[model samples]
Target: MSLFASFEKLLSSILLPIAEKIDKQVHLSAVKKGMVVLTPILLLGSMAYPLKALKNVFSDSAAVQEWFINNTYLIDLLIKFSLGFIAIYTVIAIAYFLSEGYKIYTVGAIALSLFSYLILTTSVNPDGSLDIRFFDSKGLFTAIFVAIASVEIYRFFTERKLVIRMPEGVPDFVSSSFELITPTAFIAVLFISIRYFVADFTGGLLVPEILMEVLAPVVGSLDNLWVVWFVIMLRLLFWFFGIHSAVLSPILSPIFVQYLSENIAAKTLAEELPHFVTGGTFSAFVNFTGSGVTLGLVIAMMIAKTQRYRKVGQVSLVPSLFGINEPVLFGAPIILNPILFIPFVLGGSLIGIFPLVLMKYGFLAKPFFDPPYLPLFFEGYLTAFDWKTPFVQLVQIMASFCVYYPFFRIMDKQEMIREAEVQAEKEKKSVFSKKDDELLDELGLDF
Candidate 1:
């Protein structure tokens, strides 16, 4: 068997099944769904950073500078209420979705998870005030852990019928509230005990701090270029086999989100952004013009010798400009096409990592913004708030064109040959028979 056959067998026998299981896992599904729920919130809140940066843009006008300076509080308020409380929102959302999966009371699970998370992460000030320093990205791991743990605890009790039973005559709301009493008490005590135990054990460290320290090595490795490349390749390989590639999202998105939040925080403080590989990096670079970087293929198609290829390209060009490439992917039929595999996977991966390489060398800026989908080059500019980003994107498009051109030419040639053969067959069938022509010639000899 050929190397491609071996790979196909390995994927179908091993990777595909594993991917399907991970895609359906309840905790992971909840995390993915929760992130989707928070996407709009993050997008709206992140606007504060870029909007505040507008002050630097209009520095020539003293009045505008003063206005921005005075209105800095508004931006801060937006950040404070949105990104600042991201962990809280994350826990609630994850808990609600996870509970729904367990077929339990979602609101009750959310309350327990939130309450438990607060107990573990929130601290008391010397002056009797509450401290919520961990309510941001700093508390993300703790929030995830607490949400899952608290919900599992709720599920355990509720599934086993361990809750207080209110009489049937009572209202459903009151009865549901009563049912949660036992689990809430158990979760509250468990987390409160853990909070104190960890504080004493670590000589005043909180759960979030401990988790961050423990997971530091693992989290830090995400910045490695090789690791990022491997992940990019996996996504492309999945897409090559006609998988949606979203199966990996549940595992990767939380880390991407955390890195993005940290970068946004650093930018907000006017500090150097800490992370280079972020969710925005994937959007602006790796998945440029859709997964597998098929925009280049569409470009090649547009200029092909064959009419079919040109038509598909023309129809797909508009959507590709906006990062939608399904029309080209299916039309060009890149999926499982051995002729296009090399450029689709290897070339696409290289093109995807090109901008990241520039960022690694300080030629391009790290992404801190993740704006909603806009046209290609424009979105790249918004991603890093850097003038150089659009230029880098242009280079990527050109690189994609170069990488895909040769492979596309090969496919175009084969398609042209196939089209000619098909046309010849049709012409052969449409020709009149010899006997019919003889009769026609006899009847219309003068004409």
Candidate 2:
């Protein structure tokens, strides 16, 4: 009957059960966050063979192997999806360890996530056995690290009643979890390390078979850009219609990259060699949502700056159109308002079209598709040698900024207008009240 009770029921029905299961474990270590990212990064390992798999599954390509290499760039996008697993797991793990402590269920959840990847890795590879080899080294390190985390997580769970007996040398906020480290703090450390590893690998293209990734965008015509373009457009459309961006990303990005490799293969080795390592998307702006369209959250940040000149002209430009409007939406308070939705859709549309046009022309070379993931910016340069990819990126950014700037300015001015009206109304009300009081005395009025 009460609002709180309704809310409790809703939460328990939806989020609470999931929270309860993971709550069985408590982890407060940097390693725990690594677990958060571990799933996504590991899952990306599967993207290494998208087109090839599609080629085989559909028997689509005349040369499946060639198509496979051509679309190699999608691997990165596939790998990036694994990061989502890590993020979800890490948050749940951290939340549980902080609130409920650690238990067998906690370990099971963590193990479930890891094994999910392991099973995925094994089943995906036909010839390769359980990769018990990497399991020894990487797996061992991960296990020991997991043990430390589980120990802390377990203690935190059963010992929740003793949080007041918090560690003597520790800070207060951290003591809330009954765990050794906060999820955020530990995850940050894990982030730095994983980021380092992704960038640090010396191998030219050495994601193990267990972690091999593929980009299998289903295309209609094998030799045509129109088909590829159609696929790309379909991918963009899916952002509005559905959640297949993750499934489609590995396919669309590799189209142009495949072209780039062929177009420039005879020209120079620098242009033909795959530039990105691990074959995933590097554009922070784009994700499973597609590049530049990160979300309304990005748009929110841009609008939040509090200055029209700062907020409108330059702030929302680069991010809004590229599909990353989280800055503009959250920053600007355009959220939940009908007025701002006009610019959001319009800006996104205009910015989205320009690059595809340029790619159609000779102005920009298509990306080489090694480690395939959709790229929004110059990061598309990660593909095999398309020297002009940077130019195309610059244009996309400039175009996105241009379209978003005017729209943002309009919105900012409107925002200012509303604020002025509110202030004016307040001032007028105050003056009228004081005048009425004086006039009332003149009339000798007393209610």
lDDT of each: 0.86, 0.41
Model 1, span 18-106: residue lDDT tens: 77898889998998898888887788776888888789889899999999878889889888888889999999999999999998888
Identify the runs in model 1 with alpha carbons over 4 angstroms from their true place: 432-447
The alpha-carbon lDDT assigned to residue 220 of candidate 2 equals 19
Question: TM-score for model 1?
Answer: 0.95
TM-score for candidate 2, residues paired by index:
0.36
Error of 1 at 402 (Å): 1.1
User: What is the alpha-carbon lDDT of model 2 when measured against the actual structure?
Assistant: 0.41
lDDT of 2 by residue, 1-447 (tens): 866457545644654344344333333233343333343433343333332245567465568767666775564344334322232343344434433333333543344334322422222246764433333222222332334443444444435643234768787544544433343244345534543464467333222321223222332143444553344444433333222334432233223223322333322234432222122332321232233333333333355444543544256556544535444444454443334443434444444444445544545443333333333543455443356655655654555555545555665677678878888999999999999999999999976
Q: Which ten contiguous residues of candidate 1 have the minimum total lDDT?
A: 428-437
Best-performing candidate as measured by TM-score: 1
Worst 10 residues of 2 by lDDT: 276-285
